[model samples]
Target: MTSAIPRITRRLVALLCLVAAPAAFADIVIGQVAPFTGPQAVTGKAMRAGAKLWLDEVNARGGIRGQKIKYVFRDDAQKPEETVRLVKEMIEQENPAAMIGTVGTSNLEALKQDGVLEKTRVSMFGAVSGATSIITARNMYPVKASYREEVERLFKQLGEMGRTKVGVVYQDDGLGRDALAGAQASAKTYGITLVAQSGYARNTTEVSNAVAEMVKQAPDVIFLAATTAAAIEFTSRYQAAGGRAGLFGMSIIDVQALLTKLGPDRARGFAFSVVLPTDDRQDREVVREYLRLRQNSKDTELSSRSLEGFIAARALTKAIERTASPTAANITETMDRGFETDVGGHRLTFGKGQTPSRYVDFAVLGNGGRLVR
Candidate 1:
């Protein structure tokens, strides 16, 4: 009962507190459209908490240039069409100065295809996708390393450890397609054999066939390029079938959530590639600050997704600080003019010919569900 309380608080705060700007309060407004209720809800919730924590802190300190920021978040339920609709509605009604924390490669692609970002000219930061389409889309800036980078890094490590026979489990969406391509490329580069591969439907955990396929291959390692829910389901089902492949996943797997659901026994030894420095990096001022704020808040768990949200918020705030009178156009222009800044120790630079940040760390689930470097 007590554990459920924090979950309820997070849900309420995510849905109500940032749903829309009060009509009376007028100031800086930023909006987001993401999955709040669906398979991806866990990712959405962590992102909301991390971004909101920084934004709330900014407001508590009297806001930027004495103007309070209004963060408006809407739910898309992990549907691409709904993402297009809700983002359009938010832009028309709220007139957000910018956008932040958009999730999913397909959702971002839907927005791009509909010209929502280009037409509205609102700069969006911290898009939770490493898909090439999103990275190249005009007015969309990604803060993390590309999915290709994450896959290649993992493959390189596997190659070093002489784990050459590998299989893949990915979603059949833009995110999955991008990652699968990366996996193929990385396998070729690392001299790892692509023994077998399987893909599940988007936004669903129906991975029985996929799991069966992987079990048959019995590769030395299986790379999971999937969402959190799908990853959890696959891990549970695969292990139950007596499959013994070394489970490795991309950053979207949400290590903290995995620990909670699968427990230490089943979840142990699974490795993950994280885009940000792990929580133990006390050397990073941003990591320290995030830890402090999380400990002080009602949020139940801390994960890379949450840290990603906070970092995205910090980057957007830095741009807002430089603009004369923050608006969609000026913020877009300010960010387009080669925006670069350091969030504590992690550095991000954006402009023409700029590659996304290339920082990734690997960790494995140790005893008691803690990450071991």
Candidate 2:
């Protein structure tokens, strides 16, 4: 009976260890790659901040399913080759349970060329890029409207505003190609043709030739589809040359960044398509929640990019809430289950093969760099 008591005590201790073992191993690692150290660092910082808004709250509530969400961030310097290298390193070294918030579509193509996603089979959620390939690619998911949807919205708004003679100044890359393709389709639907279209090299603000083309075309509206620096350079030079054309930018262009580049008055009336609603609109459940969260947030930039990241992180948590293991394989399996949760005012759906969200809206940069409906 004394020997039996020791066995019983050992059994009890073993059972206790099993019960308490979860706490020691309760953590989910989420990996992200962006241009954290380059010119695009502002957008990178915004994406990181927006994601943390959701992550911090989830972690504070004992984490989703008792596992704390830990993030591993790497800077790709907005370079495609470097993105491929870092992503491979992340998979082998960091071994993140999931990947989220990649920045550039050029980087996306590079990642695909490297065949990392195919080998790892990890789902990448919510890239800040407007490139259509993110949604069209296998095992990749996007929570925002494609450039086509944003352009569709932009063309409709331009029609309403009685603007015509559309022209395009695009970056000479995959992202600009996507925007240009969408613009052509949207122009057809809007019953017009582009007056002039031009392309400039990526990563350069030298839009002199493009600006000269704009000056020669004298388009009533310019569909600016370049990066922040390129777009700002084109617009600044165009306006300086006394070219008076409506600046209509895609979701990829940072309107706030442009506003800071040009004064508020110069940036005024410049509009862009966005995937999220304005913060002041309480009509939207998502905007309402975003505003409430921003009120308490130390990182409140309130740009569309930030909102996109927050929405993506919220969706990530929704999937993590159900997965028992929360590894890369397990998380990918959760995506297959078809998430139907309504985040903020947005209804997100991700299934085997489907576009996640086509939500797009247009906003004008108002007097104080505010997004006006």
On lDDT, the candidate that comes out on top is 1
Q: Global lDDT for candidate 2?
A: 0.80
Instruction: List lDDT for all candidates, in order.
Output: 0.88, 0.80
> Cα deviation in Å at residue 184, candidate 1?
0.6
lDDT of 1 by residue, 1-373 (tens): 9999999999998777556634324589989898989999988878888899999999999998778998889999989999999989999999999998888999999989999888888988888899888888888877888898899999999999999999999999999999999999999999999898899999999999989999998999999999999999999999999999999999988888888899998999999998886678899999999889888888763466799889989989998888887889988888778777998889998864365599988999998887788
| Candidates' RMSD to native | 10.6, 2.8
lDDT of 2 at 151: 80
Q: Which candidate has the highest TM-score of all?
A: 1
The C-alpha TM-scores of every prediction are 0.92, 0.91
Off by over 4 Å in 1: 1-25, 301-304
